[model samples]
Target: MIRFAVVDDHMIVHDGLQAMASRADDLEFVGAAETPDDALALLEETRPDVLVLDLRLNGESSTELCATVRRRHPDVIVLVFSAYGNTELLTQAIRAGAAGYVLKDTNTGRMPEILRELVRAGSYFDPRIAGSLLLTSISNPSEPVSFSERELAIIRLIARGANNHDIGEALNVSPHTVKFHVSTMFKRHGVHRRAELVRLAMDLQLLD
Candidate 1:
């Protein structure tokens, strides 16, 4: 069974998701929270395999929350379920470790199947934004960056907005190791902040 948790401030969303999960034989509704902190606590207790999160949680940035969950519970997959379809937010969520992006207007009845596909494939994007993502990917040059394979891997995660801790967990390395690589990359690229590094990566087409 696919254990699932939800984080959304809307009671209706919670109720709707609960009903949908209950109807699915392969899905188990673990819990729900209206805030990121509460969601983190619930995740700790339930250890759900997947978390359906709202992009806006009482004004809190969901991208940061997604990164937090990924850092704390590396095993859990986060699927962003939001009403907003802004490309910036969608990109940010993916970079922050979300495994999928689904619109709130999407048929809740189909969410169980969507979540199943997400877990099986490791990632998914709402069809609305798929074309935008494809265009963005196509716009990026195909030239490779002048870095070692490990460094390139780190750069890709960095471009995805991952912190040292998140990158460490994803790559199965120590945070210190991630930090060392990040610092080296910083010196090589003459950039100090994570945002700068991400911009540089984009300009150089270092992330495919």
Candidate 2:
């Protein structure tokens, strides 16, 4: 049987998944959590083979938690179960070491098969984003992302733990402008959080 845990805030998701697992002879619902901290605790306690993660937990992106799970629990396959079909978010999940991305709108009956396929093939992506993902992979996937001087400045400030307001003040720009730049950078870099963007910049030697 495939033992799986979940880290999504919605009780409906938790209850629905549990019901699905109960109906599937090959799947087991090990546990569930509504927060990242609880998710960590549940993982440590259950050590399940798979994790069904939501892209957003309490309005915050859970990609970092995905990375942490992969790092600390290498054997557990992190499967993203999100309502979003945003290509950048999907890219971020892939970069964070997720094994699959399944949309919430997908037929719930197919979930068991999807999980099994993920375990066997080692990766799965929603068909809705497959075309874009393919194009992205075909189009210079190895090329480094380019950032403007202003963006670099904003990134540096972000690395120093500056919020939007602080970065805007430092750069003599409005917070809204700073937000726009940051959001654009997030999409361009396929990262969800400031920390991830800073790390990517450092990896590419963009931040000195």
Candidate 3:
């Protein structure tokens, strides 16, 4: 089961999501919190696979919270569950290390599948907000983005047009692991496709 938690201030959202997860065989609603502090504590207690975070907690953006969760709990995928579709905010969330962003008004029924896709691919963006954010410039162009040695190896293989299976064979890791690394790179550069990722890596001279 995909263990998950929520960090929304609204009681209704908490109750609703708990109900939704209880119905899904593969999803476990591990816990919920109302603020960033409590969310941190809850994460320590539960160590869930995913975190369903609200973009705005008590009328303020939770970009900082997202970043903290990511830095502290790198294995836990943060999925922003927000009502607003502001492109700037979405871009900020992505840059803050949110692995998935889904609008509250969109179909909640697909959330299970979305969460699964996120765990498998390491990223997901709602179709509504994806196009504009894809075109938006990175929030901080001057910020240096570095990759681990393993990630660099995957990038070199991708640049050579190796598929995930080929890359897996070359690296002696599973194809799923290779795809996860590629998708994380896509999120890191704010790009959605492999070609975009490769081009950005080249522009950044990361492939050197």
Number of the top-ranking candidate, with lDDT as the measure: 2
Task: Please provide, for model 1 over 1-208, each residue's C-alpha lDDT reduced to its tens digit, 9 standing for 90 to 100.
Answer: 9999999999999999999988989999999999888998999899999999998777556778899999999999999997655455566788899999998889877898899999999987898776665665577656333567798888788777788899999999999999998898776444567665555554334566
Q: Give the alpha-carbon lDDT of every model.
A: 0.82, 0.86, 0.84
Question: What lDDT does model 3 reach?
Answer: 0.84
True-vs-predicted CA distance for residue 52, candidate 1, Å: 0.4
Candidate 2 residue lDDT tens string, 1-208? 8999999999999999999999999999999999999999999999998999998888677888999999999999999998765566677788999989998989889999998998889888888776777777789788544678999999999989999999999999999999999999877555688877776666445777
**TM-scores of the models, in the given order?**
0.66, 0.69, 0.65
Better of 1 and 3 by lDDT: 3
lDDT of 1 at 34: 96
In terms of TM-score, the best-performing candidate is 2
User: Per-residue CA lDDT of candidate 3, range 1-208, in tens?
Assistant: 9999999999999998899898899999999999999999999999999999998788567889999999999999999997755555676788899999998887768888999999999998998778766555455555434668898888888889999999999999999999899888766555667765555445345676
What C-alpha RMSD separates each model from the true structure?
A: 13.6, 6.2, 16.3
Write the number of the candidate with greater TM-score, choosing between 1 and 3. Answer: 1
How does model 3 score by TM-score?
0.65
TM-score of 2: 0.69
Compute the lDDT of residue 19 as modeled in candidate 3: 90
